[model samples]
Target: MNDDLKAAVLERCRRMEIPLVGVASTDRWEHPPFLPWMPEEFYPQSIFPEARSVIVVGLPIHLPVLETSPSIYYHELYKTVNTLLDQYTYRLASFLTDCGYPSVFVPRDGYGSIEVLRKNPVAFFSHRHAAYLAGLGTFGVNNTLLTPEYGPRVRFGSVFSAAALPPDPVLAEDLCTRCMLCVEACPAGALDERDYPEGLTDKAACAANSAELARRHISPCGICIRVCPVGEDRERYGRTTAAGDDDPRRRRAREHVRKYGGL
Candidate 1:
């Protein structure tokens, strides 16, 4: 029965043009040994006590134009993708509810209110990591999800469901070979050379720089995503497609770029 449900969900996702999807027990994220930035109240168990499963979905962000003008396009693309994810999650929750299962849409605001952040400074856990553990994709050094087909060009969203769907087995693809390309590409030096248990990110620095960029109404840096070898390959495929070239991969890539700008 679980397998049949998984098949149905995957087919729906494919039809929706969502390239990556998975399921993970909500218990995993709600475990006691919490990581930094993971506020206890943010856990599924805390927010949706009855949620038994989470359906994670990943949409590729393969927009090459954003990379070209990082200060102008990245934020725009991110906002678009984030909005799309919100709508998608809401729709999925409605679908599950119609099917006689309880569902909820996890709020996307990572930065808590000033009062909440003061109480819990590290309130934004590695959401991308959580998405990966949910079997949606693999983690890259840049702290982004690297999908099998789209590398780090993806955004993740999930639906918390009361139904007990069998969890998707975690993926073992360690695509980040520690090449340090992402670290090198980070203009803000937000990536550390040493890998910490929580991953190698200078979250404070990244956030500060991003905030500053937001103030200026410019796109934040996407050098890490742009310089990634896998990202480059995806970009190549996208251009080919947009130009009406012979390669179907290129055509698909082009369409993605036209829609999202860049990752």
Candidate 2:
């Protein structure tokens, strides 16, 4: 019955057009540092006493759209993806409830800001960690989850439920190329091109840069994600603005992103 339920959940996510879905058992979790907004009890089981599983789902941010990072095209698409994630996860949570399993869906981003993050340096929950545990991705030097299909150009949401589901294995192979393109591309010098959790990225620097971008109404500094060379689209997108800054291809891609109104 548990296996059947898990399969059903995966199928439902697929029906909802979610590109990636992976499960992590609550027992398999290890809590990260807590932020001020995070309650003293911060584990999955702590959030929902009966939570037995976490369903992590990924939404791909169109590669062409991300090529225009820190631009209006990418910024709006970013919000659209987040909205889709929140709505779909809410639907999944409701589906679980209908199946006799209560659930809670986590937002893609919430309570995160330059001021708040500077003080706390963490979010109440980390969906990137959830996605990592679910075998969907690994951490990159940019402090984002790197996936095989889209690198860091993906957004994620999580659903914690009482339904007991078999946990997926954590990915054994790392996906990042340790390319310093992201580190160099970072206008704010936020990232230190190391490796996963050990690679230190200055969250304050990142936050400040993002805030400055927001001041201009862009609201995001996606230099790191823009330059990653992971995933199938890497060759198509190229690794850095310097690689082909004036390439007619680059300009065409940006126009394409704008034409579509976003990804």
lDDT of 1 by residue, 204-258 (tens): 6776666565555655566676666554445555543322346666446545544
TM-score of each: 0.77, 0.87
Q: List the lowest-lDDT window of 10 residues for candidate 1.
A: 236-245
Clashes of each: 10, 0
Error of 2 at 255 (Å): 8.7
lDDT by residue for model 2 (148-237), tens: 888888899999999988888888888877877888888888888666566678888888887777767766767788777787666555
In terms of lDDT, the poorest run of 10 residues in model 2 is: 31-40
Kindly report which residue stretches of model 1 are placed more than 4 angstroms away from their true locations once superposed.
Answer: 30-40, 112-126, 196-199, 231-263
Q: Candidate 2, which segments miss by more than 4 Å at Cα? A: 31-40, 235-246, 252-263
Kindly report which residue pairs in candidate 2 clash with one another: none
